[model samples]
Target: MDQKLTRQAASRVPRPLAQALSVVEEAAQGTKLWCGVTAALACLGGRRGRRAGTAGLAAVAVAQLVSNGMCKPLADRPRPPKGWIPHDEVEDRPDSSSFPSGHTAAAVAFAAAAAPAWPLVGALCAVPAAVVAVERVQSGAHYPSDVAAGAVIGLGAAWFTRRSPRLLRRCTSRPSP
Candidate 1:
């Protein structure tokens, strides 16, 4: 597939930004740091961290399932060739649909869920968010709006999950132990 003119234009991300994105991608994809970061954020809830853990888990679960399983397939977006990813810098590549970036969704959802618990750490969430957003566009995997929407979806899912405990308890309620 031919590269979108927009993607080709956006691929001009600076060298330093590209390097920074590489580092962020490495962190997010390797060692499940996203999960670890969320777990640590849950810890900030003090005794409530345990409870928050459950909610955080639910948030992350919903986000991943929605982004990777449902949205990505439905959208059927394309990815840039191996070299086209700014750092990768490819020439000819197959075109895929560019909508609703999964990486962005996952990263944003995690940030939204954990940010409430650990405000300081929550700030770091943007690092991955930015990295994934840039990486997806730079790689021709997605358009800018695709990533924006994904962020909205992911963050919205996390927000709903965080706020739904009352609903969850109401549904899961049982006789007091």
Candidate 2:
């Protein structure tokens, strides 16, 4: 099954895309940048920024956890054909499912949630997201569709969480003085 899928992807994938994926694989492979960014966002958004400052951190955590734990595990989809090739995966072969790239999900979620206040920082998150998607493809950990789906879910989660406060306020009434 995995081999058949790999052949299908190979037959259709443009050389440019494959090359780009390779580049992403190299650029972000084993980099601890994501961890640092996660920490920074958590600290900055903790109690220093605003009443809703932690939204980014919260969104990221929720997005990644769901993507990694619930969604991926439930999907239980197989990896790409070259999954055992040993060149693509940056970390351990996750026992969990692989429908959505957790790294991509977290990156996009953080970007979307934090963009309101920190445009530059949020924008930077896109780099890692793109890299993770590309790396997933190059490493044979996921198909493009999987990465795309994960990205959509992650981004959607962030957007919803970011606006949740305002939406909740509008729905609820304050006590009359």
RMSD of each: 5.0, 5.7
Span of 10 residues, lowest total lDDT, candidate 2: 83-92
- Quote each prediction's TM-score: 0.72, 0.66
Candidate 1, superposed: residue stretches over 4 Å from native: 1-5, 39-57, 80-97, 171-177
On the 0 to 100 scale, the lDDT of residue 64 in model 1 is 73
TM-score of 2: 0.66
Which candidate tops lDDT?
A: 1
lDDT of 1: 0.65
Q: Model 1: number of clashes?
A: 9
- What lDDT tens digits, residue by residue, belong to model 2 across residues 1-177? 545554455455566776676565454433344455656665775543332335566677778777876898788887665534434342434545668777667656766776776676677766766766656655566767777877887788798787778988987866667
Pairs in clash, predicted candidate 2: 72-97, 88-139
Per-candidate clash tally: 9, 2
